[model samples]
Target: MRVVVLGGAGFLGSHLCGTLLAAGDEVVCIDNLSTGRRTNTTPFLGRPGFEFVHADIAAGPLCVRGAVDAVANLASPASPPDYHRMPLETLAAGSRGTEHALQLAAQHGARFLLASTSEVYGDPDVHPQPEDYWGNVNSVGPRSVYDEAKRYAEAVTMAYRRQFGDDVGIVRIFNTYGPGMRPEDGRVVTSFITQALNGDPLTIYGDGSQTRSFCYVDDLVRGLVAMLTSTETGPLNLGNPVEWTVLELARIVLEVTGSTSPLEFHPLPQDDPTRRRPDIGRARRLLGWQPEISAHEGLRRTVEWFRARPAEVAAAAPSVAGPQVEPRPGARIPSPRRSAPVLS
Candidate 1:
């Protein structure tokens, strides 16, 4: 199989590239390096089956010769901090970027899989979100840039499938944590790990009661591959059904890292969901995929990766300063401040 992974140098895409290469697929990685780092894919640069291209997905259609067997559109600002910081770019990638990938897939007669997100559920009212749920989302809220962009992305993906009868697969990935996750990505897993490593207080938002389901990266990658190969084209929910409270996750991070960090809390951000757990019944039936990695083991593995890459972790983590405020036990941690001013 000849596979093209857009945003290939990104945390998840990098791992996907390695996974495909290991599976005997010829891989072409396309990334702009805006958020992805070349270092992530450096190891595979010289592999006989691996090729890398540095280009923005929004710069028009990707230029790949010959037929492509598979196209995995994994490019987008995944984290809240990132999406909020680059709203237009995020939207463009989700819309235009997705279109480009689909066009490539159509042109080459390849199967297309999109790395969608649970954010599409939009502060879901349903306890365990199912694929059929229409979702409850605020289009004008702070998080709309990401959620709506993904919503549109999914819509366009479906349009391609319905109108063109294209082989399109959409996986609404839940919170996945693992070794390849960017340390400063500001997701809960990385934030908690970096904070614990630095002996800083673990921050939470909104009484610490909000819940989320985490899927291990390896398990997610497996699910992705399964979806790509399967005849089932889904807006399938792919994630571990095991749910954990924000406080529970923080405690696990502290225990795993052996950090004596205190708990800090703040108000939850706008549009932050109270609970998010994927109802993976469809995934189970269609792909026989269920998350096998527990939070404890996942966190341990993530911490080990962070510890192994001290320089990367240090560069990505937030700067430490200021005494802990009145501890808000379960509040959402603030989004990392944008390094460069975002031009509206």
Candidate 2:
């Protein structure tokens, strides 16, 4: 199949491009280096059936030649620090950027896939978040730039399907980590990894009780590919169902990297979900997909990748240790920091 991957130079998008190419599929990778790394697609530069376009879909209309079979829209600043740094761009990516992808797919009569996120379920009241759960997002909050963007993307996706009879699929991705993640991304996994490797304090913005489910990138890409091939017009949950606390994840990162970095406690960031775990019943029933890699194995591979990049990891150290938000006596742990879509 011929595929157009928007933001194909990002951590998850790059992996998606690599997977599609490995399956003998033709891939046209589009990206603006705003937050995506060119190095992610460097290996695929001369690869057969792989073409890279350096452009932002939000900035202008996309141009692709020949027959396009599918358009996988993964464009955006996905990490917390990135979206926070470029709020307007993040919002544009979700709103304008998603429309461009949908328009491209509609033009070609191809399947459109929207990569939504669990962040749409802001501080979810539901225990195990299901597709049917309408999210509790803060439209005016710091993370709204990303959360509302994705929510808007999902809304626009459904509109395209209903109004234009476009073929599309939506997948609500959870916290996925593995190789290709930028160390300075400010994600819980990346931050902990970099801080541990550099022997810096692993900052826990909260008291470390907040929970998140981490899916391995390989497993996530598999689910994405499955959704792309299937006819399911779903906001299917794509992530590991296993839950882990912030403290648990921090300990594991330290253990995995064999670092003695001390844990520093601070106020939990406002809008940071107290808990997150996707209910993938629909995904398993519809796409026959479920994560297979354990968190440990995924972390081991990720640690090795970061370990090889000593300079990047070292440089990421200072950013990981940011200004702390201290909780006063008997005060709630709510902080003023912003979350991008979903923050840990």
Candidate 3:
């Protein structure tokens, strides 16, 4: 099979590329390196089955010459810091970038897989969000840039399927973490792990009550492959259903890394989701997939990876980016930015 992975130079995209290559698939990886690091794809540069293209579909035309079997659209600013910094690019990736990939798949009569996010279920009113939830999101908020982009992406993907008979699938990915995640990505896992390894104070926001479900990258990539090969046109929730509070995650990180970094509390960001957990029953029934890695074990492996990269980990000083909040007149609403965004 031949696969075209947009944003293939990113943390999750790079991992996806490796997994597909290992399965003996031909891959044409495309990325502009805006937020994706070229180093992530360095190991695959010389591999015969892998080809990397330095291009951004959102910026201009995407010309891939050959038979395209599957298009996996993972080409957005996935992290909070990344999307926050590149708001326009994020929107473009979700909208124009997604359309380009869909168009490419349409052109070749190939399968299209859209990697949507749990953010579409923004600060969700529903707990353990199911695939049907429409989500409670502020379209004008700061986080809306990323949230609306994904919502739009999903909508466009479905439109393509209905109007043009494009074979496409959508997956709302939950918090995924593992090796190859840039330490400075600003998501909670990487931030906590990086801070713990550096012995810096671990920052907690919004009193650390927010909850998120973390999925291992390997588990996610496996589900992606399953969806790509199968004929299911679904917006399945592909993530670990086991949930953990931000504070609980922070404590676990400290214990795993054996760091005594004190926890620092701060104000919560606006439009932060109070809870996030996916109900991936559809994925299990449809694709025979479920996350196998426990957070502790995944973190252990991730911390070990970070440990090997002392320079990178040390350079990623944790910073809680948001406004301050004084205790609500003795109510003491001590919180910081949500246990880190639940983005990939």
Clashes of each: 9, 0, 8
lDDT tens string, model 3, 212-288?
99999999999999999999998999998999999999999999999999999988888888999999989999999
Worst 10 residues of 3 by lDDT: 335-344
| CA lDDT, every model vs. true structure | 0.84, 0.88, 0.87
Clashing pairs in 1: 204-331, 204-332, 205-330, 205-331, 205-332, 206-330, 206-331, 208-330, 265-328
What are the runs in model 1 whose C-alpha is more than 4 Å off? Answer: 319-344
Clashes of 1: 9
TM-score of every candidate: 0.91, 0.92, 0.93
Off by over 4 Å in 3: 323-344
RMSD values, in order shown: 6.9, 7.2, 7.9
lDDT of 2 by residue, 200-262 (tens): 998887789889999999999999999999999999999999999999999999999999999
Top model number, lDDT = 2
**Model 1 lDDT per residue over 1-344, tens place:** 99989988988899899999998998888887878889989889899989888777765766688668999999998887777657678888898788888888898888999999999999999879999998999998878878888899899999999999999999999998888777777888888888888877777877889999888899898898899888788899999999999999998888999999998887787778999999999999989988887888888888988899878766765623222333445645434322311111
Ranked candidates, highest lDDT first:
2, 3, 1
